[model samples]
Target chain A: MNFKMRQLFAVARHEFLNQFNSFSYWMMFVIPLIVVTALFKYVNLKFNFNNSNFINMVWGFSIPVLTFFFCLIYIGIIANSVARDKTSKLSEMLMSIVDAKEQINGKMLGIYLLLCFQIAFYTIFILILSKVMNNNFLFLFIGRVKIGLIVYSILALFVSLFMFLAITVQFSCFITDTSQISSATMPPMIFLLEFFSLSLLYNSVGFDGDNMIWIFYIICMWPPVGSTLTPSLIASGNISYLFAYSTLIIQIMIMYILYVKSIHVFKYGLLSNKKKNIFIEGFKFR
Target chain B: MIEFKNVSKSYDGFQAVNNLSFQLHKGEILSLIGQNGAGKSTTFHMLLDFIKPSSGNINRNNNLNIGYMPEERGLYLKESIKNQMLYFASLHGMKRVEALKKIKVWMEKLNVVGDIEDKVESLSKGNAQKVQLIACLMFNPDLLILDEPFSGLDPVNADLLIKAVLEAKKSGTMIIFSTHNMENVEKLSDYVVMLSHGKTVLKGTLNDIYNQFGRSKLDIVGYNNLQKFEGMNGIKNIDIINDNSAHITLNDVSFGKYIFDDVTKEGYLPVFNQHYPTLDEIFKTKVKQSE
Candidate 1:
């Protein structure tokens, strides 16, 4: 790697280790895994899941709840991770050594690596637990969900994470004080919650009507929200694989553009002390 | 070497730094002394490329290795001092083993009074500041900028820090530091730039600064007839501190010899001193002049 890449990785590694060693980061990572696992275990014990309905119920409930739980954890983690540097006044020192874009990218990469670890750890634990308990429902659920849909769902999850993390980092750069983090990151959290609510609504009520399907199509095109809704739409057979793929492409493009634009805000916001509108500051590319 | 040619920075309509120019060469320590908001931090920021000058040119190698300590001191409160220093050293491209060795040396050299494994929060305020300095110093940066490095440090710890800075200077690291303390500036600076309200009011060596004001202050003790100098030609003002002692201000340096001769006519006096103004006095006089 080149010098710039080395510096970027140094930042990423530092951030990762710092967060990895923190008590709160572990709370955010481990608690949700335990809570969701217990909830799943309860479902396993309470309901007789010998049919496709049970599979649908379990998968549907798990996706949104898991997403919401992890979202809450990630929101806190990312906010603190970004704000800690600025509030502690470490950002100014780091800024002298590392470029703003490098710092943002490094921080995101570090947290994202941790998120990947969480996902992998959670998946492995769930797999082992299901096998150990001889819970056929998990296998049944996996068998029933088409491979393509499973792939699309994972893709959509990652896309949404990337997009939302960019938004959070952008807003987080504006935080000069730790008290301002929740408020600084509120816009992205609001976006996530709104779509999270929609995911729940569509999953439970079933948007089977033509108009609602069109709305799902529209939601699937909008970045962030689209990333969350695309998988469910595909799983319901409301949208084809091609449309899902197109929306995925659209989401990636939007994420890329948004990330590039956020680089500017990231550069300026990290140094600014004033509280400014995220939209105004984030969109002002210079 | 780094050179700032006619640098000026303004925010909205308020100038933060105005028409500042200076040069720093290898092994030279330049001290920036100014009151709060005197643009000392702004000068450092411009050198670090954190901010751009609205007008002027700063010429230097773009990739010069630099270590900077901001005025508002900070460290990762939750991490061990060792961990944070190693992380920063790695950012500066130092190997882990090298950084560790350097950390041990710096901690001992600075009398940090804590274990390397101690979290920054566990250390006292002064020790934490020492850790911050260690982070900047361990990398052996080509150019080191310390803003208010002396602030919050006790006299003993300040001396330890001073020794460490002088060591860096001896190793040929070009250094610039800003402080309100004129004593440290006099001790460490090869050259000094004093700023007043974003303007360069005094810029030169300590001797040059003192020479500009001349030997205008005289202190005499155990001398009688202090009233003889009152309203005397070439005497600007006189303050009789005690029956036999007085503080005299001269209109010209040449008058020192005249006073010395007059006071010693009878015999040797216990105290009759003639000298240039102190850095503190020069600083005050310059601030007042700019205001």
Candidate 2:
């Protein structure tokens, strides 16, 4: 391979393989599955969502919740990985050898791939589980929903998680070390998810779409919020396909710009060990 | 050739590397000697283009492949040595086949006494340092920058490391290292650049620096009291190594003869050999003068 590809692959491979040595990676997948199984087992005792209406409602609600859930796990992982390199001084060594932009891009790509693979794995597991159980109506519920809208919504969720992961990686540039990782990931994560979490609750309540058309549209236009909001909005018919797509496209553009701009921040953060106000950091151009 | 022309780096009003100028030719081994925060690693960082200089320029022959071992060891300690080294090798644009071959060669050549698949944390401190050194060399970089490469190694491992470095130097790779160890600097450095608080304090070839001080180091042993040499003409400084041995530095060469003649008159002198100042003494004296 060429030099650029080699550099990218080197970083990407390291990021990808590093988790195989850690128990936390397995824990991340297992914890989510355990939570799902426990919640489902509890719900089985209390109520049954075998009916079409209940299955549809639960599906719609779970889409946004799952999007945020997986995205939050990924954000934590990506940020922790980025911050560890800096704290460990590996960034110093790695940056010296590889281009800073390539390092960040490679890591982002690697972690993003890991997320995709894990999600795919879990999806397949659930599918097989459904087949084995014979009583699982999840496949039936999915077949009844608008396939086009669900596909579009899943696409939105994917982009949303990608954007969130990008933002987390960006924040990691300012983090000095692992100790600052929580500060780097926490505020932005919780704050961004808070708005989405509330909106998700609102969407689940079966409110009249007419009351807050503008609010839904605005929320759908902003990312981290928009990614999840657009999908949930689609489920309830509060958003048009054109509007959702346009908002997502706009969010993608913004995320791309942030990524391009963040290359400078990546270089700046690794070189200086001094802690600074991260708010002012975003506006300053290197 | 790599040349630094009055390069200076400042971070938030604190200058990390001052207006330091040094040129290094290919195949030359230059050692940067300094204490903590002496801008040794900063200079290496500037060379790597991780951070730009606040002023001036560093010129290099285009697109040089560099392998750097930082003062702070930063490999994945929990990961297998093979995994981390392969990753580093590929980062330098080495193919997997070529990288693994070189990794094997270096592991054996550097006397790395562990399985390549072993986690780095499982290795002894000296063995880990050897693995790190191998990582620096396996890629066959055009320029190899090792910051405190021999810092944590035992004498045996240090010998192995020094041999590997010399072999690299012999093969025409320009090597630059930073260390507090004067003996290693004396052994490996073709030229030396001494940094104190981000500024180049003393620099030149081993011979040139020694000649600059004049050939005037008198090591006397088996003599308890040499009080007669105090405030004497031509005697510069006296450092007592122990009760029986003292290192006498003279400003004048003829004064050694005079002191020898005078001291021998009293008793039988065991050792009164005159030599050049060691790198350690020179370093201490230079650093002290600046302080």
Candidate 3:
């Protein structure tokens, strides 16, 4: 187990370095910065607001959009990471030495770490940017930064990222070309975006305090979609903290099940050259 | 040792490997020769447990370390040669320090001279292939499986690869690979398995197989009268090489001595030697026979 963990770390480190040095890495960070900065300035001038509520909204919305962007980048990286091996014929070499299970797990874990690093950077950048502009901006962006919200969001992000990692890993299995990876990943990214937008809209509609309980209940119990959105909703008083925590546990359980299922599909799919639908193929294993 | 006992595999409804049974012993290099869709790749897939056999069992000694180089070159084009090799080596349980050291040695030995940090996409096809080969061997697996390892290689690089394979064999690694090149098979294989239409058409030691096909040949010098042997009962085929020499094929070993005696009677002491069948000839004959 120690050896396995070490191997997984090595894989993650390699993956992070490879992406960090690439032109695409800079593009991912730069594009978001450009768009977010443009929006911040445009809204500040147009609204003439004293507080950075506009900037906070931009930052919050950017988090989910950033999630989509990172998910796409992650999909490309993971798919090509595996597909490049198949196309260049490196998988044959690697598979000769390592079994399928280790290869998939190592890669998924590596990508997860990379995602975490991106999130940390984004968080730090937002915090510092807010502080430099104005001290109160931090509270607006983090929304009171209570210990509970901080802890809950961290838990929520980890679970959400893990679920995404599993999906991307499974996507990598069936694809031999990197070009096809985006199509396989688009569905999950779209789902996350929908839930994110819906949750934000629901908060904007100004439901009464009593109505918040049912809304929170619905968000908490949902499977994969709920895992990411429920905690953010709870942190914002759109849902109860207790419901968010319980949902998190359920989400973890679902992630564990999906992880196991992904491994089975990964083992069979890696060796196969035949084209397949990702959802159908995954379901077949179950 | 690797054993496939009545192993079968199918993709969808199409059978790819059908009830194939074979044992690959340690230190032996086995060549699987067959045409496209003849179950060669399918067999390799089954060995790696990439696809479960529909029936029967494939039993290895244990979770023994094995190396594989598939026909479709698997490589990360965006990654550098050194980085790619290091990642693969790590998966095999090698520490970073050890993997790096071994990769350096292999790159040097394989004549991969250049910036190790250069992305694979920038390298020539041949150089990329060399890196791929190094990635497999760096782990020092007990069993090495290569699917057409020589495909797309120039003659010189192919020879170099063959030399490397031979050196690996000397270190007691059991090698199983498939190829269309008969010369390489003849040079490297102690045992050969021929597949046709998802079935094992031929399997045996190289010598044992060639010997079974029979040896027959004719040599002649200063003999223009090839018509004299045409009427002979033992002669299966005859062709005049030139005005002075003619080649003859005897129906059986018994006919060779009689043909020699007859040629001598004609006051022509011809030079004749029995020739063992070449792998190419045997492969064509067996495949045709199976069809």
Candidate 4:
């Protein structure tokens, strides 16, 4: 690999290890597994329900909720990590060795690797739980989940994660101190909470295709916001598979555009010491 | 070689560095001396490409390996010294084993009074600074930029840092450091750039800078004829410490020779020395003149 790529991965590995080695990160990783396992044990003992229908419903509800929780936890991680580099003043030294683009990308890549690990770890735990509990959760989940909705949700989930991560990183660049991190992360947090609310709302009250609300379609087609909504809408049978996939494509395109803009802000925000309005200054070309 | 050709940096209406020009060859140590906000850090920042000059050119190899220490010291306070050093080494593409070896050697050489596994927050202020220096030096960078490296260092620790820097210099690293400490500059620099309010007020070797000011200071002891110097034409000011000793400032360097005869006529003068102004004095004079 070339020097830039080497530096990028070095940073990524450093960031990943830094978080991975921390006690709190491991706590965050392990606690959820323990809680879910305990909850599963409780449900099995109380209801004695291990049927495929219950498993399918559990997954349908759990996917979006789990995603929301992942975004919530990792957003703080990404923002704090970025702000820590700046507040500690190590960003200047790193700037000499690696480009700002590399630093930002490396950090995001590092967090994504951790997210992957979390996902892999949870998947393994679920598989093991399924076997031990005598419930074929994966088989049932696969047999029942609509393939189109599955593809759309998988695609939307990843795209939404990247979009939220990109937005968090961009805002976190404006943070000069630990005190400013909460305020800097406010915008992305609001968006994430809104996306979560929309997902749960649509999942409960299915969209009506006959008496269509144009606004719901807009929400379902826009990126990040649309990421969960489109999959939920598709599952509700209010949107066609073609429309759902097309909206996924459109969300990807919007994400790319936002990625380009966020990268620009990422470069400027890392080095900026002045506490300017991110909404105004973030879009300004330096 | 790194060369700055008529470089200038301006922010909005303020000129942070104004038409600066200098060149640094391999194995050379150039000291940039200035007061706070005197553009020393700005010059370093431009060289490191942290900021760009608004005008002129800085010519250097695009791929030159550089190590930079900013004015504000920084380290991961919660990280082990070894971990952070390895992370920095990895950034420069240094092999892990080789970097570990260098870290051990540098820490010992700099007298860092802490274990490699010690978190940086556990180190004393001076030791932490040394660790920061080690991170810069261990990779053997081609161009090393240090800003105010001696600011808070005690004399002994400063001497240790000086020795380490000199070693780097002997190995042919082109070093550029900024400092408010004139003594360290005088001891370490092969070339000096003195700035005042973003303008280059003096630029040359220590000897050259001294020569420009001329040998206008005279020290004398056990001289009997203090009265003979009272009406001297070249005397700018004189303070007679006693009947046998005095310090004199000359209006012209040629006047040193003129006073030599009278001081030695006493037959056994213990001290008679005429010398150029000290770097500290020169620094004061130049800064005063610029202001």
B-chain TM-scores per prediction: 0.98, 0.92, 0.91, 0.96
lDDT of 3 at B141: 79
Using lDDT as the yardstick, the better of models 1 and 2 is: 1
Q: B1-291, model 1: which lDDT tens digit per residue?
A: 999999999999999999999999999999998899999988988899888999999998898888889887698898888888888887888899999999999998988888999888899999999989998888888999999999999999999989999999999999999988888988899999989999999899888888899889999998879997899889999999999999898998899999998889989799888888889988898899999
DockQ of 3: 0.60
lDDT of 3 by residue, A1-286 (tens): 7766766666677767877887877787677666645545455533324444444344335445544566667766776676655555455555555566677777777777777787687677766765665544434545634567567656666666667767766766677666776665665666666766765664344347585677656655655577656644553455677777877777777778888888777766776677777656644654
lDDT of each: 0.82, 0.79, 0.73, 0.83
Each candidate's interface RMSD: 0.9, 1.6, 2.5, 1.0
Candidate 4 chain B least-lDDT 10 residues:
B261-270
TM-score computed on alpha carbons, candidate 1 = 0.92
**Which of candidates 1 and 2 is the stronger one according to TM-score?**
1
**Every candidate's TM-score, chain A alone:** 0.87, 0.86, 0.78, 0.87
TM-score of chain A of 4: 0.87
* True A-B contacts kept by model 4: 0.82
Per-residue lDDT tens digits for candidate 2, residues A1-286, read: 6788778877777787776556888887788777655544445532354564555566668887777777777788888787777776677777777888888878877777787778788778767766665445555666667777778877877777777776666677777756777766765677557856765775677557678777767766766677767776666656678878888888788767777767777777766667865545634665
Q: Of 1 and 3, which scores higher on lDDT?
A: 1
Which model is ahead, 3 or 4, in terms of TM-score?
4
Worst 10 residues of 3 chain B by lDDT: B268-277
Between candidates 2 and 3, the one scoring higher on lDDT is 2
Candidates 1 and 3 compared by DockQ, better number: 1
Q: Candidate 1 — what's its lDDT?
A: 0.82
TM-score value, chain A, candidate 1: 0.87
Candidate 4 lDDT, B154-234, residue by residue in tens? 999999989989999999999999988888998999999988889999999988888898889999998866867876789
